[model samples]
Target: MEPIDDLVGRLGRWSAGRGPLFLLLATRLRQLIDDGVLPPGALLPPDRRLAGALAVGRTTVVAAYDTLRQEGRVVRRQGSGTRVAPAVPTPGPRVAETSNPLFLHLLDAPDDVILLSCAAPLGPPPELTRAYATMTLPADDLGYHPAGLGALRTAIAGRYRSQGVATVPEQILVTTGAQQALSLLTRLLVAPGDGVLLEAPTYPGALDLFREASAGLLPVAVGPDGLDVDAALRLMERHRPVLAYVVSCYQNPTGAVLPPLKGRRLVERAAALGVPLVDDEVLADLTLPGGDGPAPSPLAAYEGGSGEGGVIGVGSLSKVVWGGLRVGWIRGPQPLIARLARLKAVHDLGSDVPAQLAAVRLLAGFAPVQAARTRALRTGHDHLRAELGRLLPSWTCPPAAGGQTLWVRLPYGDGVSFAQVALRHGVAVLPGRTMDALGGSGPYLRLHFLLGPEALTEAVRRLARAWEEYEPQPAAPHAVAPGAVPAIVV
Candidate 1:
């Protein structure tokens, strides 16, 4: 095989007309493979060497590989690497309709790029070195452990108690990540046909996880205030949902924080309607400098003493600490925590032990992490908000009063198209559809203002380019032949 690094260097600086670098590469490659530009049994470039030459993370190359594998355009060998897969026959649809539309990479790193695509920004807390260096996993015989260790539970409980939550050590069960916490919760409570209330434009991964569990999603429109309680009440009363997952503080994509009263009221109403509330406090670590402290103790407090009313809280170190920490926990009824623990046992046995210790040690210093993030967000958002205001002044962007992102409506109102064009400009952005409840949108783009200073600026610039390129393009009907209708969206 040709040196893949050399190969990566040799490929022309490709245009990101439809999506970002990796996806554009994957899309073009998929088309070539289908057209036999690279025949079956032909080897594609290796990932590591390709990533090395591109100066992008290995994860980016991995995502390109994943997209190809998912599209059935490539089959990869472990030691031998990837090759063009044999093509299968398809429907005899018309020529125009037959062009394969590829799925973009869900998690891709870009080129010569400041990546604003990923949600995670900060690195491990400073103490992480001492935390890991001095900490020790047990010397016991190796085997599957139950849920989290007693030490972590105690530490987590103690941490929450400082916030006046008074969560019992026994009530907390650590999981690999908040995503798993959510998945386990769904497995325990939601069966097919069960209704789950999700804040519209909520966390996309959480939405995807819930959908995979086969639960029906009822979207409650979100605003700067928070989840619309009145609309949510209507949905709950009508659907009597089995679960209503929420992010009261710093709602994802929107950057909206729930007022103290709103958080309390959400708990009251959900309890009154017999719906269990899953509070996603993953982004609640208030880092947008000078923001208010956590809204009056979380909804879980209503069930605090005896653990009634069914308000479960989920948290993770991923956002505030580091995504690679792979550590998160839940606070609710000790009995319910026990139940999820059983569900967890079948999933990954237990949260990573080493990572968990690092987390416990890091929690004591959350103040510094929170302080650093607050400073960054405050500084970044000011520059970012100003840029948006000066550049695309027509749209309204809710001041990221305190979160990792800025949610803004585009002046022209087709965020999905602009996102596509941005990829072509060497930027990756998530469209509102990814955050949409039913895969549609409200002209929103979740702009992560928490990126490094240069990255944030470049990201906004790409947004401008994406908007410029996309707005004047004719609609699908005019772009393609009349009978060649645009494919149905999933």
Candidate 2:
């Protein structure tokens, strides 16, 4: 049992946020539970006693206790009062693999629900259409190049060279998409119970993959300028992680671009630690109109020389061009690439030949495609931000210069529970808890701005209605000053 004064001291400034009194208290209690400050079987103060201590109405403490009870974090008995619940055992790999909201949305896409859960381009760009039109096949070829087609490999290596990372065709391996690239690397590097370091509040797909592999996830904080290199290095020395994954350019949910200096330090430290680092750059090319020129060169570029044996770069056409094209590649050392190719052969023999041919042409003429993408993304991003501000002003939505999604912080209630209310109102937004390995992003949501202006307006309107219904209105609403809420850098 925790002492009431001690618990009160631990929950410093719990009422600083703009949420309902109950929700703010509940959020603070939830954090304590998650941080193990209030361990399982620890007794909580009585509702009346806590209300007296905090100087709030007894109803507020009751509601807060009820919230934690509903989440299975606490147990309340008729005579004994409330206590923290025992930790549940981790689910099996099969069950954990498909537990993400992204997969759930895909499996059961209800009609009429505006899906802001998945963040992929709507369709192929005009350049992709033209590439398919000009795609050619050789009559003499069997097309079983498991390491990717020769022309496509060459094109990818050439592209790397242009970006200041020296590369050769042998260092590139084509996969179905960036997801497959991540899967292959996880299979090659991580064993059951091995530590795999990554960013907190990262891409949900990657979290699903790591959980499926049964790897112990070591999460480092990511900020506006990108990953915390010093903290990552400390974790590496402490945990000796087998593999480290980072979305260096235009990070998935947060849209943070890693500075070159941090990228250099990270790869250098990882290399010294003999940790295989996978730099996921799928969203790198989707730089918006107001972004700082282009995204910094791939993390591999910072390693100098051939960039072999240190950082592995993964890129895809899915984000910059179209998801249907299904073209992605991995750039690594020749030996690693060769080993991955053999592993890939057992899966699908090789990627689709026609798609690779088209990718080659697309890469040859990518400047125009990039220009078109950035223009559309800029419009969508601005429109979504404007609509969110106009309709749901209390939600803190930081401006993302690039990438498809916005990481939003709700003013009051947690995202997981509120998302259900949002869904009932005909919209599906991803809760930030799904993206977090430690389940700490309770008040955040990942909302993609891929929809056009009209659709975005509708989505925000539905979300506003959902918020109004879900949150209890106080007699006098508190006004949050502009920038009062800190941005949640994933």
Candidate 3:
């Protein structure tokens, strides 16, 4: 049973300027019932006790109870003071089934809608814009470079080298974006019905690509401590998957980083099991402003010592630079790079050369650009946390170490229903079910924190409104909710 005083305290902004305080209290109680905060069969305090707790007249409590009884929302027994009404059928469109999982759908959303679905950073680094402006394409006409431009490839490779990994341009393959690279690799590595191991709640786009390929999936749990190495090792041994994908740094949605020990163990185990590992470092550079020490090394760094030649590192400037740039590359053994490049050529001829030039310039100023992004993202994340705490205190959202989104668990309803409600309130959020490969993630929502503090504050306010509109009616607790490319440049 909820304490009367606590309920009274929660009446923020709901009781102001109300002519009938008893009616206002009744409305609040109804909402509480709807929100499942007060479950059915929950006994309410005695009218006199409640009045004393709320510092209101006993007549007000009696009036509120009488109103609830008249509406059949509550029943009063001789001994039992009051009990919530039984489940009632609610009529509405099924939001979960109709909700669009496609990220592109938000592109057409009205300007006023706050899109929390896609985690794309607000804007590109200013340096990237400047770079693109000053960049000059080669004099050669009708540039068709099947392999990426030589300059950008070398720059990407050089960064890998700086990380103590010996990489040459030949061992790199660039594509329109990381997604294309993923598709090409999936095509090359996974045949129809082949097993692929992935973290349970990983990138939705990756899951889409794998499903399109008709690959059998094996999911391992990724918790706050990161991926379970023992479970991963066991899965690899049993499934012997053709490819294993992981987000080792600043993982998507959850923002859980794989600790160094777990990372090393995973690489070693994968090598032992002969299962190739695809390490996604797309958001690797977006570490928070301060850290205990340097970020963990790429899982691919262990590939040299593993001697199995399985780790393929996929990096993108999308998070650190800009998503529209669509500049991403795969780093792996030269032989694998050559094969992927051949497949890539058959797909899109090559990535845009101008973007490649711009990426080269952006990398040249990587430090400053990344520092600025880190600062902005840190502020955005903190603001999001503060707003959630102040507005929707019941929702649980842990701070993300890094990454664009916060994976949140709702206090009462499931993510799909809440998302539908959120959309009607002009905020678009990605339901957690879309990210899970095995259909296990429900009751969760992935919220992006890339907006400015002001925007995030307003967005949370909208979310709170939606939360209020969400009738917690316990209707059967309607369960809520890479490759080395050796090819010449054109």
- Which has the greatest TM-score? 2
Between candidates 2 and 3, name the one with more favorable TM-score. 2
* Residue range with the least summed lDDT across 10 consecutive positions in model 3: 481-490
Query: What are the lDDT scores of the predictions, listed in order?
Result: 0.68, 0.81, 0.75
Candidate 1 residue lDDT tens string, 386-454: 888876777778676566777777765455666667778877666665565433343566777766667
In terms of TM-score, how similar is model 1 to the real structure? 0.73
**TM-score for predicted model 3 compared with the true structure:** 0.75
Residue 446: error of model 3 in Å? 1.0
Candidate 2 lDDT, 1-490, residue by residue in tens: 5568757765655776566889878877886565444656779999999999999999999999999999999999999889998766575544423344445567677778998887888989888888778767889999898999999999999999999999999999999998899989988887766778898768877776776565666777777787878878987987698889999987877788888888888888899999989999898888888766878898888888767868999999998888888889999999999999999999999999999999999898899898888888889989999999999999999988788889999986677778778989999888775665544566788998888899999999999999999889332222221111111111
Listed in order, each prediction's TM-score against the native is: 0.73, 0.79, 0.75
lDDT of 3: 0.75
- Candidate 2, which segments miss by more than 4 Å at Cα? 1-102, 473-490
Q: What's the residue-level lDDT of 159 in candidate 3?
A: 91
lDDT of candidate 2 at residue 141, scale 0 to 100: 94
